[model samples]
Target: MLCVRKSYALPTIILICLTYFLFANLPPGAESPSVNERTESPDTPDQANDGRLHFTKKSEKYPVSEYIPLPTAAPSPIPQIQYDFPPESWWGRRQRVKRQKAVKEAFTHAWNGYRKHAWMHDELSPLSGDTRETFAGWAATLVDSLDSLVIMGLMDEFEEALKAIEHIDFSTTHATQINIFETNIRYLGGFLGAYDLTNGTYPILLKKATEVADFVYASFDTRNRMPQSRWEWTRSAEGLGIEPSRNTILAELGSLNLEFTRMTQLTKDPKYFDAIQRIADEMEDAQKKTRVPGLWPLFVNAQDMSFPDPRFSVGGMADSAYEYLPKEHMLLGAQTKQYRKMYDAAMDPIKKRLLFRAMTRDGKEVYFPGNIQATLSPGRETLEPQVEHLKCFLGGTVGIGAKVFDRPDELSIARKLTDGCIWGYDIMPTGIMPEIMYISPCKHLESCPWEEKKWYKDVRDRLAKGAQLEDLTGMAKSLIQKHGLPPGVTQIADAQYKLRPEAIESVFIMYRITGDQELQDAAWRMFRNIEKMTRTEFAHAAIDDVRDPHTEQLDYMESFWLAETLKYFYLIFSEPDLVSLDEYVLNTEAHPFRRPTAA
Candidate 1:
């Protein structure tokens, strides 16, 4: 039994009108079809005389053009969404500035606490003023917070963090199996981000990024090009026993493109690119073999790349895999057709197979992607029809990719999915969404329909007396088959809210893309709830249960709470132009990397 590197983990944000302006100007790829290539060519001469006049004989003053300009035409005529809010009076602007400052203060408060008690550790236990190590004492929180500190202009904290980063000895190797996904996003992603932000002001950031990436790259030396989710740095490839039939999770295999690709771009090392790209290649192979068209099952055999679990989700095990599809394309300036094609392929199936539009108990229509169960028989799959707060990331991911790819249909999906997520928050008693939610299939209780839905409700009614979501599984073909819609979120299992960032992350994107004031207000409400519940004398801690705002604290403060959650909250309320999404593509973890200026 090898020790896995103990680490606290992880998570995405926003759009801007100017982002469209910049992205629209990017050099087109070879396969780039004009936006209107699918539409009428509009090359008719004398439109009224040519019998092209089906609509009111064409305007006399404003005749239809013989040729419509290309979709990439300069200065888009399409209207952009503007942020709706009170007038920017001096006082209003002053309060907005204060809000930004308050977020900075929250960051500083967490930073100071971490510095005093957990300076070289992964995260802080705010309740007890103690430190904990994750990723083998890598100071993950400090490194992850570097760019945020830089962004917020905490020069002194940035200097201190840099000093700590400089002294980090990546030469120390460990036999503990580290989580490749967590290490890459929080550590490698953080360093690359800080490095790019400062224009290479501190090469130590790159040095550390390369070091960690090199160490992790060892895990990819697999026969099937699927890296183990866990790795031991000391022995690198040789340490972890090579089980020919070992299964690897999809998220780990699919989420590394941005960091690895960025490394290649910065260092001109094709090996770094090749190491991760092989996984992408393997993904292309796996999709063809999997029963699901675009969605891959959660578990795939590392040796043959065959899916095992028959279950697919945009949740814990598989969330970031699908998340990176469009992002990889955007990261590389949509020049990588593999990424774009993969993304396009995944979106439709995800909507058709995994997604469901369920009516809440309160009669609101909520569209969510349920976990899919693939059977031996194709097209006979079942759905769990529940939503995880973690999966809230899908909305923003969809929204940003839609914006980049010029897919208005996908943007509509993004909006509906985001609205569904907001409904999750609204239904929670404490005004903060729970870690898991069951979107009751009951459009009407009088119908008492759907075997899964009925069983779920019965199980919950019984559970009110005392039962577990995991325990109620004795009646079906197998315990797994016994599973159904989760009894309407029976007891909000895993009730604790560990300062997760997904909901706010999507809100940030929604506000930027649609300029929807309601999302902004929702974000504010969530922030105030978290702040009110989690704030402590030293620093903030994760609350035990979002269901009960008064529930005891969890003592733990995940680094992402600082890196992503609060950062997004601050940005959602800030000026949209601060860092336009057009010029930067965000990694799955919400670390923004500069998009290519050229094709």
Candidate 2:
């Protein structure tokens, strides 16, 4: 789950008075510790050891001096074939029908569990048959799962959730500072998606969505127009003019355009569009000044709008910024070249700086995406190449961006990265990739990949002696020793899988684009593994570690497990005509938004 800073539970009047007192005395350009700065909590030992189950995981700052620079040799691109709409005839209509039904059944089981044990709560802890309130007491899982319910043709459940939406009072304020980005994507996006799915028949959904958006809009009252990462709705904005502290998260600002911009079209209110447009422009402008094009530092100063350093990764804090680029262009009907231009500019740097091909112990070469901790020095030496499973979402994002922008090179890069992610799953004991891994970017090592390398043990011995290993704490030493690695060259930095859907989300998009049967099969295998491992008496619970899949269950069921993972699984198996990608673009939360008509 995404970590958020929370305000102490205080009476509404006292909280409002405190806010007024704090911000009232601040001078122009004087920084106050805003929610954005406080929002980033250091990784707890558990998070560092076993990664969280969400894409919005913790962001860590690595020193600039600890990286291997990118190889001067050109990256070998994966070949791409022209994608035909109807992929293949191997899976007959009957098989597809069966697969879809099975997905629905699984969803039904999970949903029924939620209703039975943890109805009207943020999420279900299937292990304890209890509910947890992470967000406002608004039944987040049900709301997030709205469009998926309709897509699966679960009319009874859809209606049940619909009635619940009618009674949801978004006007309520709480001690927990609502994370505007998450609330917008999962809840507001969910509402808008369900409304569109139902042909806008449910105006109450729209009304509730607007209420939430309106309540959060106060956070954008800053002079720089960046929204504070979190806000207490209890405090009135009448006298408070405190902007985000010196630092604001890129993902929080960059990911807002789709949801809020769509709201503008729906309600015909420019406030929503105007608020995000300025930030979008800032993102585009920041690219021009960045050392690596299309990549922005994780944090930027809210007052000066200056990015502090050159640390870049398509995970956690920076994940959604790149995701929104092509999406923004598509959502705006490709009329605006700005988003496409930003996306294009970013890809060259991304591929050059972040792509790596590593050979495992068995002499099989695998390509993977890695983060670049860049430096601004004239001869910048530090360029760490590491991978987070969350970054795997780039596979699908890049694929979609390639298709929309007609960039074959981008598609090729996507193919390589997606294959790498699948490789992670293929080699895992439970057939699920861990949250984070590090790939060996050891290029042209003298003793590695010699012509005499015939056995797995030989490669393993060479790598163990030659390549710098990633698992400094020996978490994956046993696997490394046993597997004798390069083609399967991966160190599980964080072994937990918090029911994340990025890899599967990529599989869905890949199948849709390439009509690759293997991708579909991969999705099926993943779904089955997830179902088998996560099953509890009431509902599925997230596991503490994917390595020990069934040993222990984390007492939490994140909303996204229902919203994105199963939804993508269902869509991949269902008929292509069910939810046409051409007709809609799914937000980060898997909520489908109708594409806007060409302006």
Candidate 3:
């Protein structure tokens, strides 16, 4: 359904080669007519988000000059004392009978502890980690756990917690931006699960889920295509200056609308389907203006999607939505005509012609997967090659980065690419991922047997060492996105840290989705690695110095990666189609839409 305008086919491979030849001689990271100088957004230390700060979305040259306030919610109702869990039959009587009680306990404990505080009391504490109703700042992730919980007959507890989540609001900081996205996305997840459980009908819980979406939509304006990554953490949600790039927020919103529309088809609500149309329109505008005939760059912050600026290098977010559309729609109804038309037009030539097969020194396409799936850690940005360009191509064909399997003609092709990167770049076997991998770095990849191999090896190794090396989930994303990824590349990957829980998580997703015996082998390998690398002593998830003596950093607890790792691991062994049919991101602040009508 998605139409790629310019594919390399068998002919353009020639043009790509010609382009490669012309630029191949240039030094890596050499400036091209295509790669523009980066302009930084002006920093206004004093301006803030609560209607007290104001900044334009596109201009990076100046600081915010004004401020606006956010709307204040009336005091929310008393938090519910209790909630319901799905019954034994929901998850199959056999498993439900065994785990229902445990789920009830977990949900109840989480609910009671979560419900005690008021949003009035340090609701802004998400940045500081306040106890009153926060789900580790990544609540949408819990939506998956919630589904499992419901099946295990613990929906009651979720309903109670859901009530609490509906009431809390994040109006400031990057976390606020993320939370805003999550609430909307999660509400959709919850709505879908409820529909499935209730036999294609909306229940009371569905309405509650819609309420969450409605509140988020009301808080953010869909008309304003460009969204700020951060707003002030004050009562009046004003002076929202645009962040570095708005595509991540915007794409997340657009993708969510697609989900809602498909939900509408099932539930017969025109509203859900129509909800994302405007965002889609915005995306169209963005494509026309920014079309590089290759990939969209990172500097798009326009209120008008019709005009995506091409001067900047694209980042990770946009790529995520583009490549994810096909399969995700099958799960969320992404196959619909309206959504398919929208995405196809946006993908353009990059899907076909511009996609590369190896790394080159210049920013020209050479392949090697552009960047390794290195994790971004707190504060640090960029690997050695990226240097000042700290951001890795998080998701690359568009900005966030896209996974590749174009030459599916050979299963060995993907591995060949991986080998080029891993062996050549001296990539860490320990699991840290970079946000981007440019065509060219510097002297290295000496280990690679061939030119391509050498290039990839150098790229991955430099990135792993320089990168925080924690977000290995990219590997899983790549596996499913690329399709038919071997177990070794997907699961048995390198990490920045000798001991990486994130790597385990990647293995989990890979194994769950593929159901390949190789993936199972990878999972077993991951299980053993985790056992050897981490220790459970003194009631904490601490690092194992004896085995994973890579870093001496002692203040280690199971990071969010660990939770995700466990989630995937349990899923691979427990559920087969865990993430195959869903989009990984959700954004609420980008749009104000009615909830999904599908049950």
Q: Please write out the lDDT profile of model 3 over residues 38-100, one tens digit for every residue.
A: 232224423544432222232222322332211122322221111122332454544523432
> What local distance difference test score does each model get?
0.68, 0.70, 0.34
* Model 3 lDDT-worst window of ten: 387-396
By summed lDDT, the worst window of 10 consecutive residues in model 1 runs over 53-62
- List ranges where model 2 is wrong by over 4 Å: 1-84, 87-91, 237-239, 361-365, 442-487
Candidates ranked by TM-score = 2, 1, 3
Evaluated against the true structure, the overall lDDT of model 2 is: 0.70
**Which order, best to worst by lDDT?**
2, 1, 3
Candidate 1 lDDT at 144 equals 85
Q: Taking the candidates one at a time, how many backbone clashes does each contain?
A: 0, 7, 95
Query: What TM-score against the true fold does each predicted structure earn?
Result: 0.78, 0.81, 0.49
**Collision count of model 3:** 95
Question: Which tens-of-lDDT digit does each residue in 494-529 have in candidate 1?
Answer: 566778898888888878888776787788777777
CA error at residue 443 for candidate 2, angstroms? 2.2
lDDT string, candidate 2, 1-599, tens digits? 22232466457755565445334433223365557533433232221233321112122221122322211233222223224556536657677778778888888888998988888888888888888888767789989999999999988888888888787656553334567788888899999888877879889878878877776776676666667666533222222233564666778778988888778768876777777777877778888687666678777776678887667777878888889898877777665577878988888777766667655555544556666666656225444546677877888888888888878666666766787787777776677777876665546322346232223332344335455446432524554655433243444557777888888888888788888778888887888888888888887877766665455777888999889989999999887766667767789998988875442
List residue ranges in candidate 1 displaced over 4 A.
1-92, 173-175, 237-245, 361-363, 442-491
The TM-score between candidate 3 and the true structure equals: 0.49
